[model samples]
Target: MRVEQIYTGCLAQGAYYIVSNGEAAIIDPLREVKPYIELLEKDGVKLKYIFETHFHADFVSGHIDLSAETGAPIIYGPNAAPEFDCIVAEDNQVFELGAVKIKVLHTPGHTMESTTYLLIDENGKDHAIFSGDTLFLGDVGRPDLAQKAASMTQEQLAGHLYDSLMTKIMPLADDVIVYPAHGAGSACGKNMMKETVDTLGNQKKVNYALNQPNKEAFVAAVTDGLLPPPAYFGANVAMNKKGYRNVDEVINQGMTALSPEEFETAAESTGALILDTRSNGEFAKEFIPQSVNIGINGDFAPWVGAMIGDVNQPLLLITDKGMEEEVVIRLSRVGFDNVLGYLKGGIEAWKTAGKETDQVDRISAEEFKERLKVGESVVYDVRKESEYEAEHVEEAYSRPLASINDWIKDINPKEHFFVHCAGGYRSMIAASILQARGYRNFTEIEGGFKAIAETGVPKTDFVCQSKVMKA
Candidate 1:
């Protein structure tokens, strides 16, 4: 028997592939299906089932598309009512996968239909549990995301999560490997470990959610400090439940490569937003005017979901030459399938075609420090609330990039502001959005707060302990 965790860094999501005796089962797949199909063909195994832990909110799952392509039935845990055809397996039901068995543990807290799949090897010993968002290495899934759908408060869901962990999961064997759906960078859980796989024994010892003394305590701990989920999350969940455009069709439609003239024409005709997926540093040097940059190298998909605000916002991409397809695929992963095309020769072609380009003013940390010393610049700390509370510039205003839309209204576009994130990635994203929205008088700190902290610029560790706890 072979079990593989296919981890996608951008989403910090994991999809599992389990194979035994020419049969295969996939767990919580991403939107793209060709890779899984190729793996199945290469292994000489048929896809027997597509197991969904829950209707995902971060990225559209490939279950519907994969099932349609491979004739594999989609499986969900009890209480799931997807609009499409699926088998809603009862708690403790077992499904055979050639020489092995997979048992469904209806651990519903992350969502009403959230489940963990226990894999019993051919020897009939429990080997691993694909503990979806129900359990992570150092944390449990945040209970707030599914509140509207479940008609339950986050505290109530946390109660259910506590029960699910204690009754359904904690009783598993010490040596059983725990494979979770997401890792540290995911918004699905707070304080997840960087490691994707861990032994159940280790988790019991280290995971805070697993060690809670009582149900009330567990609910309080799990429901604490959850930032509002990204704007596109609800839409992605709906697409997952009701089915969406075939990924192949989406890819075909988005992979069109338009020359500079053609790309400009399409933008003028369609009113599509230009998304430049180049790195933050390179993007700061040159880019299409009005293009928003969310570097493909960082938390690309989640930031795209958070900043774009609309799942179906039409887009035209300006990508590095070889990364066009990757840009398209990652956009599709987050249900952004209306990408018109990529700029064929990239930003260089735009320059050659005499099209206007804009550059974000990025100053070195030293320059920023000098400016601040002169008492001429207003600084904006665009990192999260916690990061700001931990340690920040002595006078910078907190304007987290995640909720930029709301806070942006408070800033006067006419005044100059210096923006920075933990590093440069998020600051550029904020800069791009500001640029697109006609806020031009801003300079992004080249290395963000990481570099600023090193320059000995006046800093403070003013922890608003109570306010931090409330956030």
Candidate 2:
């Protein structure tokens, strides 16, 4: 038996391709099924089975498309999967595909239908178990998503999660390698290791979720620090159930470039919005002037999905060559595919053609501090609540970038707000949001809060995340 791990970095999602005796099975596929199709062709393996650990809440899944393309039956656990036709896989059910025998284990907690697949390799020995969301390298997925607020309290779901971890998943052998559906940088779990893989034995010793002395502590740990899911989460899940439109065919139909004058006509003709994936500095200094500034450097995918509601529409790229194809592919991973094409040489090409350009002023942290010393400008530390609690600027008031727009609307729009986050990425996001919301007088403090601390700005014990030392 051969096992291959497929990683999608942007989403920190992992899917597996297992081949035995010329038969292939894919577990937890993303929206674009082309990669799996190509892998099968190259390896000369026939597609046999497709399985989803649970109906995902974050991204639109490719299970239906894989089932349709491969003619392989799509399987989910006994707990109901919404939106698609599927075989309800049973616990302890053994299914053979080529030389591999797969035993399904029902492990609910991440979601009601989450499952673990135990694979017996050709040598007739137990191998890895694909523990989707139930367990991770060092953490477990938050139980708050399906258990919505005010209805099923966080404590109730945490109890269910405690049971799932203790009784269902912990019984597996120590040697069994654990393959989790998600890794670090994923919102699915709070403390996933940066590594993509781990073993049951290692996680047993280190994973805080399982290391808890009892269910109460375990429940408390997993129920916190969940960043809100992208605004488009519900829409993507809805689309996944009804079966999303074909992104490949939509790409094949083709799109054309247009002058600013022709842009309106193209928008009328093709119905695609021009997406500007540039830094707030670049977007602010100058632009095509009509595109939406959703930079590729930050959390670009989910926001793009949220802003561009229709996946079938054409996407005009307003990014430099360094960021173009990547921006397109990231969008594609989330099932957006109406890419007409990018500006040939980016905005510079259009500008050289005598087209108009737009501009906004961006300032460094040093300059903002100098201004602050003179009492001319103010700083808005735009980070998340958890992030603010972790660490931030000394004098700058913390306002999470996610909700900065709503926070400052009642105040001055031209308030000399200098923003920052854990790193510079979120400051860029805050800068863009301010730009989009017509707050042009703001400046993005360079290097975020880190820069302020580096300058010897006095801060508090809460300024840096030192509690991990206790852990």
Candidate 3:
């Protein structure tokens, strides 16, 4: 038996490719099916089963397309009662893909339809479970997803999750490896770990959620104000229930290169978002002020997603040629097909074309300090509430990026908008978000709040060399 973990990185989702003998099965497939196809073929396996632990609320799954193209049977938890190419899996139902034994456990906490796939390895001695959302390495799925499609309440879901983790997941052998459907930065769960996989025993010892003494505490821990799963949750669930359309096989699917003027014109007309996937410092130096800064560095997809909650709009990208395919593929995996195209030749193309550019205005720490001495510049720090309370620029008004939509509700949109994140990536994102809302006088800290400290600029609210909670 062979098992492969596919991390979509968009929403930090984990999909699995499992095969035994010459048959293969996919669990929690992302929309881009090419990777799965490649893996199965490499293993000399035929795609026979496509199982979703539940109807995903985060990103659209490729199950529909995979099923349509491969003539594979689509499987979901019994409660999904889904209409197409259907197989409703039941608890304890055993199946096989050659020498491996597969068992399904109905664990409906994250959603009414969530399930865990327990697999007995080819040797019949090895045991592993795909604990899909119901259990995680350190945390569990967010309890708030059941707003309406739920047959379960928050308490009910949390209770179910607690039972699933303790009763079903915990009973597996100590050495049995555990694979989850999500990792950190996913709104599906509050405190997901970064590890793609973990052993049941390691989780039993180190996982905070699993370590809780009772069901109530576990439920309380996992359910507490877990950030709302992306605004796209409802759309994704509906797409999954009805079944995904075969996007890759859909005709005329290749992306085009967009000229500066053509792209800018499209932006003006259709309100497309221009994403600059350069480093935070590079973006702050000068960029089309209209662009959102989501660097091509660490944790690209989720951060890009954190900035833009809506994928329905066209994504016009500005990046080095090296990152074009990556950016496109990441978005495609998450079902972000609204990408109109990428810049024909990145920012240099616009420069060569002599097209006008806009820059997000920035102020150095010293310069800002000097201005504030006589009150010329009012620094509005755009960090999270938790970050603000811990330590921040003395006079800066705090409005977190998470709450930016409602930031200007109290202050008029015409008010000076000076936004800053730790290193300016988020501030640039915030500034352009304001730009989109017709706020003209927006400025961002050049190197972010950290730039001031690092550059020997004046700062009154000095962080006292203590570790901060990584929120």
Candidate 4:
């Protein structure tokens, strides 16, 4: 028997592949299905099942497409009513895959249909549990995401989550491996550890939610400090519940290459937003006027979902020449399938054609310090509130990048200021958005706070996050 955790770092998501005796099962796949198919073909195994932990909100799952291709049944836990055909397995029901068995444990609480799949090896010994969003290595899934769908308050869902963990999960043996769906960087759970896999015993000791003395404490702990879900989350969930365009069709449509003039004309005709997916430094140096930059090298997909907010927003791409398809695929992962095309020869072609370009004013941290020594300068720290609270440049205002759309109107265009994130990526993104909106009175610090911290700038000691949030 072989169990593999296919971890995608960008999403911090894990999909599982388990095979035993020429039969295999996939758990919570990504939007792209070709890789899984190739792996199956190479292994000479028939895909017997596609298991969905829940209708995911972060990225569209490939269950529908994978099932269509492999003729494997898409299995869900009880109370799931997806638009497509699938077998809704009851709690405790077990399915055979060649020499092994996978038992369904209807855990719920992350979502009504959330489940954990327990793998029993050919020797009839419990091997591992693919503990979807229901349980992370150091945290439990946030219960707020399913409030609207389940018609339960976050507290109520947290209660269910407590019961589910106490009963369905905690009873497992200490040696049983726990494979979670997401890790530290994911928005699915706030306190997830960096490690993707852990033994159940270690989780019981280290995970806060698992050690709660009672359901009340568990509910309060789990529901605390949840930021609002990203704007595109519900739409992604809808696309997953109903169906979505085949990834191949989306990719093929997005692969259309257009000359500079054609790209300009298409943008005008379709009113598509131009998304530049180059590195932060390159994008800051020069880009098409009014184009938004969310660099492909960073947390590209989730940032796109958070900043763009609308999946149906038509987008034209300005990517590094060979990265067009990758940008499209990442966009598709977050359910942004309306990609019009890409700039044929990238920004170089546009510039060669005498197109007007824009650039953000950037300064090294040392330069910023020299300027600060000369006089008072407005500075905006675009890091998370928690990071800002931990330690930030004294007098830097907390206007997190995620909440930029809400707080941007407060920025006085005439006032010159400095902007920075942890390592300049988000600050550049913020700078581009600011420029697109005609706000040009800001300089982005070259290396963000990481650089600023090294320049002997006056920084505040640890403070309460509430103060930062209020700012």
Q: Find the candidate with the highest lDDT and give its number.
A: 4
Ranking by lDDT: 4, 1, 3, 2
- Model 1: how far residue 439 lies from native, Å: 1.3
- In the predicted model 4, the residue pairs found to clash are none
lDDT of 4 by residue, 255-300 (tens): 9999999999999999899999999899888999999999999899
Instruction: Estimate every model's Cα lDDT from 0 to 1.
Output: 0.91, 0.72, 0.73, 0.93
Error of 2 at 222 (Å): 1.8
How many clashes in each structure? 0, 0, 1, 0
Candidate 4 residues lying further than 4 Å off, grouped into runs, are 373-375, 462-471
Stretches of candidate 1 above 4 Å error? 374-376, 461-471
Give the lDDT of residue 208 in candidate 2. 80
**In lDDT terms, how accurate is model 3?**
0.73
lDDT of 1 by residue, 319-423 (tens): 888998898999999999998888888999999999998899999999988888435568999988878887899888899999899988888877888999999
RMSD of candidates 1 onward, in order: 2.0, 3.4, 3.4, 2.0
Deviation of model 4 at 161, angstroms = 0.4
Measured against the true structure, the TM-scores of the candidates, in listed sequence, are 0.96, 0.88, 0.87, 0.97
Cα error of candidate 4 at position 45, Å = 0.5
Candidate 3 lDDT, tens digit per residue, 145-255? 864777567888888778877778877789999889988767676656778888989888987788888888877766665554555566667777875546653212325
Residue 232 accuracy (lDDT) in model 3:
58
> Which residue segments of model 2 deviate by more than 4 Å?
148-151, 253-256, 265-274, 279-281, 290-292, 303-316, 322-326, 335-345, 374-377, 457-471
